[model samples]
Target: MKRTRALLIAPVAVTLLAVTACSGGATDGAASGGDKAALVIAQGGLGDQSYNDLANAGFESALDATGISGNTIESDDVVGQGEQLLRRAGQSGVNLVVDLEYSHNEIIGSVAQDFPDTDWVIVNAEAEGDNVASVLFQEQEGSYLAGALAALQTSNTDDPRINEDKVIGVIGGTAGVGIDKFLVGFIQGAKDVDPDVEVLTAYSNDFGDPAKGQQLAQSMFEKGADIVYSVAGGTGAGVIQAAEEANHYAIGVDDDQDGQAPGTVLTSVLKRTDLAVETLVQDFADGAFPGGETVSFGLKEDAVGLTDFEYTKDAIPQSTLDTLDELRQGIIDGDITVWNVVTDGYPDFYSGS
Candidate 1:
C-alpha cells in the first residue's frame, strides 16, 4: 500500500485523502528505508486562507514532488494539544515533523530530545536540540513596503477608495514581539514616507474571530483610515470584508490575498511559508535537512514581499508602484534597514502593545 496520503485530524473526526505518487508510508518511520513527513497545523487550522493553509500547501507540494509519504495533522484545540500530537507522530515513526504552531517553540526542544531519529522544524521561534531546524521570516521587511505604499495611497484622491485624510491603520491578532514584528515595520515605513501620517493600531486578541477583526477595522475606517493592514491570521478575512463594505482598502498577510476580495484588498505581505515548508521537505528527502541550524528567509531569499497587486494594479499610481520597488531594492541592498521587533525590542515610534 504505497500511497501518498494526508490524514487531517480534528477533535471529533479525521479525513483522509489518497494519491498514488509516493513510495513511502508515514507509519514506516525514517528507519524503514523511505522518507515520511508530517505537518502539524497551527491554531487556526487549514481554512485560514492565510498562514496555516499556505504552509500546508507547501507540505503537499513537497510530498508530491519528492515522492515521500506525508500526513497533515490538525485539531480543534491545537494550542493545548501540540505536545501530545507531536509525540504521537514521533512514536508512529514519522521521519520528519514540521510544527507550524508558534506556541510549540518552548516545548519542542524537550520533545526533540525524545525522538533523536525524527527531524523537526519549527516556525517563527527557535528551539534547542540538534535534530531541530528553526525557520524564521523577516516579516518587517515586506511590511515596510506595505506601509509605505499605504501611506502613499492614503491621500490619493484619484482612487475613490482613498480618503482625503493622511491616515492608515493596522490590526494585529495579538500584541507581542511576534505580531509587532510586522506592526513596527509598518509604522516605520509609513512614517519614513510621511512623518505626520497617522497610523492607527489595534489588536484583535484573537486570530480566528472575523467579527472582532471587522469591528476593529471598521472603527479605524470611521476614524478616517482608508487603508488597514491585517497582521491577524484567519481573522484577516474579516478585515478584507470590512474594506469591501466600507469601500476602503485592506492589506492582507502571509498569503497572496489580493484576489480574495479583488479590488478591496490593496496587497498582501507574503510570508512565504509555503516555500519554506517545501524547501525543508525537499532537503529532508535528500538527507540535507539543516538540522541544528536556523534558516532565515527574507526579501533577499524572495521569501517575503508584497503581492503583484494583481487586481488593483490599474488603481495604483505608477509613482507609488515605483516607490515600492525602490524601497524593496533599498532594503535588499542594505541601504534601508527595517527595524525587527523580534530582535530589537519596541521602538519609540510604536510601543508593541
Candidate 2:
C-alpha cells in the first residue's frame, strides 16, 4: 500500500495492440503471493466521492484481502497520459490492470496487444482483447426506477418537500451517450407513470464543479421541478445540496448518497464499480479472466438498481414500493422495457442529441 510510484515516462500516441493476458503475469500464482494489480483513475480524479472513489475502494479491498500488492495511478491528464501508464504497468509486470476512465476505453484496446500477459479491466464501455474484460453498468435500468419514484412524489402535496407541480428534471455532466443513458431511462419511466409529466433536462458540462451543478439544479427547482436526478458525478453533489437548500429531491448515482443530505437525497442509482474491481481481481488470481467480453452489470446481477431508501422509506408508501417491485420484475422478465440510449438509441423527446 505504501510503495513508490513507477517513474513517469514521456507519453506517446504510438499504436499498440489490445492488452491483457499477453503472456503470463508480473507475478504468477497470485494466491501464492505473486499477484499484483493497478487501477487507473478516471478523468474527474478521485475524492469526488462518487465513481472514482468507489473504484479505488474496490481496488484497495482487493489488495488487502487477496494478499496482492498494487498501486492506484491518478493523473490530471488521463487521456494524454493513459497510453504511457498502461505500457508502464505492462512493462512493470503488473498482473492485472483496471481502468476507470471512459475516455481510455479505445486506448486500452489498442495498448492491450502490447501486454499479452496483463489482464485488464475497462469500465463504462467495451474493449476487445484476449486478455481484456470490459465492465459496463446498466445505468439506464437504475435511472428508470429513480424517475418512477421522483415522478410519483413530484405531484404529492402531502409531504413538505413535495410541490404542487408534476414536473421533474435531470442534469447530466455531459451531453454524450454515457449521461444520456440515465436521462432517457428516467424520462421513459416518468412517462410510463404520467404521460403528461413535464420532464426537463440539461447538461453541466463538468463533473467536478459543484457550484455549476448547484446553479443548474436551482434553476430547474425554481422552474417548478420538485425532483431532479443528477448523473453528473462530483457535480451531482451540488445538485443534492441544491435540493436540500430548496426542500426538493435529488437522486444520486453510482453510490448510496441518500445520507449526503439526509432527506433531500431521495435515493442513489447504485452502480457497483467496487464489486466489479474486486471480482475481476479474484477471477484473474483464479485464472478465469474472461478477456474480450463485455460483461454488463444489470438488475439480474444486482449491480445496477435503486437503494433501500433507509432515510425516507416512511415517506414512500407501500403501494409505491410494490409498484416498483412489479416494475423491477417486469424489467427482468422483459415485460417492461426501459429505454437504453446506448442500445436502443436516443428517444423521440431527445432527438436532437
What is the TM-score (0 to 1) of candidate 1? 0.91
Tens digit per residue, CA lDDT, model 1, 27-61: 32232356778888886667899999899889877
lDDT of 1: 0.87
Candidate 2's C-alpha runs over 4 A off are 1-30
lDDT of 2 by residue, 160-197 (tens): 89888899999988887877898888988888888888
The backbone clash count of each candidate, in order, is 1, 14
Q: Give lDDT: candidate 1, residue 278.
A: 92
Best by TM-score: 1
